[model samples]
Target: MDVILFRFGNFPVTVLEAGLALGLFVVVAISVLLIVVLRQSRSRADAEIRASEHTHELEERISELLRTQSEMTGRMQTMAEVFGSRQSDMMRAVNERLDGMGQKLGQTMTDTTKHTNDGLRQLHERLAVIDRAQRTITDLSGQVVELQTILANKQTRGAFGQGRMEAIIQDALPATAFSFQQTLSTGVRPDCVVHLPNGAPPLVIDAKFPLEGYNLIRNAERPEEAKQAQAQFRRDVGKHVQDIRERYLIPGETQDTAFLFVPSESVFAEIHENFEDIIQKAHRARVVFVSPSLLLLSIQVVQSLLKDARMREQAHLIQAEVGKLMDDVNRLDERVRKLQTHFGQTSKDIDQILISTDKITKRGRNIEELDLGSLEELPSSERGNNQPTLLNPALKSVPAGE
Candidate 1:
């Protein structure tokens, strides 16, 4: 296959030379390819070796991680157990504390309930008492209103005073000791007349009061009006005192001093305080202004005097009873002396009987030791004299051998 392809510049080229050149290029390409394959193979081998070493290291790390994870798991389990036990203990303690607190709360609530009930009961009782007190206050208010109504009317007010005086005298003195609305010797009727004991004149009590002028004095606001009202009150009271003295007093039938009974203590006090001249004039006229309390005191004195008089009248009866008691005591003493004499005679009789018993006892002893032969040895006169006076009839029939 030698053929001429091209000519070199200085030499002619043959087909054999072109063929050898191509063959040489092919050889060089083959060598280069072999070199490249060998280098790639060695690099691959080294990479495989490195990959195996890394895999071994990774396996070792995974095993170590597994061991550490197991240890952590065990520690976690231990911690869980410890926490569970602690939780159980805490739970038990909390339960116990809760139970105790519950009991205490229950007991406290019960005690509070009991105290609430007791307090409510006491409050109800107090309310009831307050209700009763309210009722009493209402009654008292009604009575006060009624009294005011009575005092507003002159006749009723006088009747009220007379009634009060009558009640006082009737309560303190017997019906015989006092008389109500009694006509005096002068033909004037007094509210009360108290008969004193032992020939003393009767005491007069007049219950007519001059309340209008006193009410005027109390109601006057201006000083000038008050002065006029006080003067009027003084005149009214002085006139009342004079009327009582003239109407009730008598020389021998009634006491020289007569009581002008004022129903109210306040009215009497007002008269004495604001009208001193009235009191002086009243005293000089043998007239006495007496309030309810003063009248009661005088009545009590009269009662005591009556009591003393009754006691004096009963003194002789008591003396007569004492004389009869002395006579009974003398009779008792004489009877006791007779009983003592009888007791002494009985004692002497008992002594003689005891002496006879001693002699009988001596005779019984002699009879007990006596033989039939000894009985025959005794004289008949001595035997008859020696026989016991107190021997039983059955013993008298007993044989000497027995």
Candidate 2:
């Protein structure tokens, strides 16, 4: 078989055959080269497609990361805003509390200072009065010695008893309630007389007590002397009781019962403890015994009774005053009603005056913008008086206090 199938015009036929072989060889080489190029291009295109897919995946992941970062940034901003607002509120509350505490502290300090100053001033005043009190104590000691001397004498003792009784009576009753040494119709003078309410019988209080016999009984050394002293005390008390009953116990002039005041509580106690029989005899004789304390208590009861009687006597006067008070209250109510009526009238007049004033003010403002020549040129019918005449409600009517 021949290698070349055809040939062109050639100088040598062998060269032409060789050229066709070379051309066929060259065409085969070109086909191989094109196939290699196509394979390389396919591989490169596959690599490019994989790179593009990977790049797309990377872009998506980057976008997601960016989006998460943006969301996180927004949350941080919101959290920051909330924290800032909370901090502001906390600071404001703390400031307000501090202000309140400061005010309270200042007030407490001021009060404490005032109290401390008052205490210091009182302390100085009390110290200044101490010297005067010491001088008064020395004078009181001398008065006590003089009082002891006054109690030693018989006549002075009687006068002292009367004076003490008068003092107790004065302390308990009014000056008009009791009388000193009142004389009865029988030409007998009592130590003191009490005038009672409702024409009750006057009570006579005898200040002379049988304390001398009691003193003898208490001071006796021998038992026979004590017995003798005790008997004398009984006789002395019985005679005194008889004398009071005969002189002071007149039926119409005084109460049937008279009080024998034991000026010394010790003497009164000794008589009651040892001489119960004597007390019974005095009771039978219509004579009552009283210690100073008992006498004061009796006077207090009398004073209370006097107070009640005085109130009963003035009952009509209190009722009249109460009636006057009620009439004044009624008159005050009537005056208040009249005042309310006056106030209502004043309010209504004031409202009408306000309306007139507002209309006048509007007309005044309008007049300021007007031309005088134009106003003069205007027809009298067209130039209506818009300015309202204001009236004072207070001038028309006035309210007076009740």
Candidate 3:
């Protein structure tokens, strides 16, 4: 290294001095480097301060976000609890309503089943009754058919001849005034005998019912057979009338001049129309031939005579009974007058008793009123001491002065 030296006024200079000066210059350069290092450190510190301010601002924003999140979580929990409680209540109410409906439906079904069973039972009973009635009707029809068959036979029809004719005559006549099949002194038995009111001899009625020929005439198929049967029936009727005259027409033994011949109704009609001469012959013999209808009219004539006599006797009885009744009515009138007198006396006694009862009742009412007035005259303090108290103490006080 080479060194150069220069001198200024009032200074000394050397080569070594100049070298020292150069060393000093180097030291100054080192000092300047130190100052630069310090300034850089200060700038670094300023940058660190700015970073810390930014970190503080970010921390405040994070804290605000955390608070908002906590509030939202709490609100969601409260809503969930409220919703659960409301759902539970709704489920319980629905269960109760369903149970009530089930019970009602079951009861209704039972009632309907019982009603249906009762209806079926009633229908069965009605059907049984109808069946019984049908059986009864069939039995009655069979009995009626059997009765008709019996009436159609010959011997059975004859069995009803004289006795049945007498029954029919007796039914037409008065019962107490008529007799049947009476035997007279001439050894003749008439079908019917009637007694008069004055004890006269009985009238004679002979039964001359011709049934066999009439049944044959009705049963004939051809018109010739029917005509032959009718002629035979007519001859039979004539014979029966002539026989009745021969057997029963004794003048004083039967009646004075009349006798009755009771023929079957159809035979009598036929004889009157076709063989009127036969009836005329019977009339000439002093024996009147009579059908059931003529016999009924003759009985009515006799009944009228007997009824008139009975009415006369009953009139006397009624007059005596009426006189007795009048006497009883007079006695009843006297008893009614005495009862009226007793009723008047009883009414007057009742009135006097009622007046005495009223006087006693008035005296009792006056005594009760006097007792109530004495209670009113008591002093309020004395009344309160003597009176009964109610359960509530507030009711013990009465209104002032009354």
TM for candidate 2 is 0.49
For model 3, name the residue pairs that clash. Answer: none
The CA lDDT at 133 in model 1 is 100
Candidate 3 lDDT: 0.66
Q: How high is the CA lDDT of each candidate model?
A: 0.82, 0.79, 0.66
Q: Per-residue CA lDDT of candidate 2, range 320-392, in tens?
A: 9999999999999999999999999999999999987886776566556544454666668766977532233
Tell me, by TM-score, which candidate is best. 1
TM-scores of all models? 0.66, 0.49, 0.38
Better of 1 and 3 by lDDT: 1
lDDT of 2: 0.79
Kindly report which residue stretches of model 1 are placed more than 4 angstroms away from their true locations once superposed: 1-61, 316-402
**How would you order the candidates by lDDT, starting with the best?**
1, 2, 3
